[model samples]
Target: MSAKYNHWHKSRHSDPNGDCVEVAKGSGGTIGVRDSKAGTPDIVLELSRTEWAHLLTRLRNV
Candidate 1:
């Protein structure tokens, strides 16, 4: 599962010591998303590049 993404990084606005989300570049034009807090189950969500951009846009508008 770890091999699915190259590298994972949280957003710049993320709290360093609190629950955070991480994203990584996946194979092809995919994006990988997961939670980085301790004790959280290792779950990953894969999205296409277009879907990722759309999600970001919607988030920014909220």
Candidate 2:
């Protein structure tokens, strides 16, 4: 969402071309992900803490 409301963090490895996404911890321990290139406050994905951990584990395995 908006930066004023959500503190979004981008990957440290992201390139200058803006090919990346931002993530933030939301209320009730939910996680929000959004496109870094998009200026609008649009959350592309939302996951619970456990779901986020599972996704990261799966991604690391790949």
Candidate 3:
């Protein structure tokens, strides 16, 4: 996820009702997560590359 990640990516599991989280890659190896249902001016949860990987692993195990 780089320049192509400039746009938010919602999961395939996202429902029509818009209940999902979106992920995007930011500069300096930072990752951004935000609510898909959050219209505009939403708060983004920022994570480092390592943190992002850990989160994915934890989620996958869940």
Candidate 4:
């Protein structure tokens, strides 16, 4: 079955002008990110399960 994902929340550090990145996730192992402003393409940066975990760990330390 295809798991569903949707934009949950906007970033707290988002631009005051409503120009920010929207993020979502799927059950499989992918993150969906896109620009909040109109007229922009959705940027889907796919990562392997292992890669995702490593990335998360690195980000937490940042």
User: Root-mean-square deviation of each candidate, in angstroms?
Assistant: 2.5, 3.1, 3.8, 3.8
Task: After superposing candidate 2 on the true structure, give the runs of residues whose Cα lies further than 4 Å from its correct spot.
Answer: 1-5
TM-score of each model, paired residue for residue: 0.77, 0.75, 0.77, 0.53
Inter-residue clash pairs, candidate 4: none
Candidate numbers, best TM-score first, in rank order: 1, 3, 2, 4
- Weakest ten-residue segment in model 1 by summed lDDT: 35-44
When 2 and 4 are scored with lDDT, the better candidate is 2
Positional deviation of residue 57's Cα in model 1 after best superposition, in angstroms = 0.6
Residues 1-62 of candidate 3: C-alpha lDDT, one tens digit per residue? 23234678888878888789888888667888888667753577888899999999999999
**Tens digit of per-residue lDDT, candidate 4, span 1-62:** 24455654577779988787666676776665556675654445555567768877998899
Better of 1 and 2 by lDDT: 1
**Of the candidates numbered 3 and 4, which has the greater lDDT value?**
3
**Cα-lDDT of candidate 4:** 0.64
Q: What is the C-alpha lDDT of each candidate?
A: 0.80, 0.76, 0.78, 0.64
Q: How close is candidate 2 to the true structure, as a TM-score?
A: 0.75
> Each candidate: how many clashes?
0, 0, 0, 0
For candidate 4, report its TM-score.
0.53
Q: Which residue pairs collide, candidate 1?
A: none
Candidate 1: RMSD to truth: 2.5
lDDT of 2 by residue, 1-62 (tens): 32232788887778898777788888656788877777776645778789999999998899
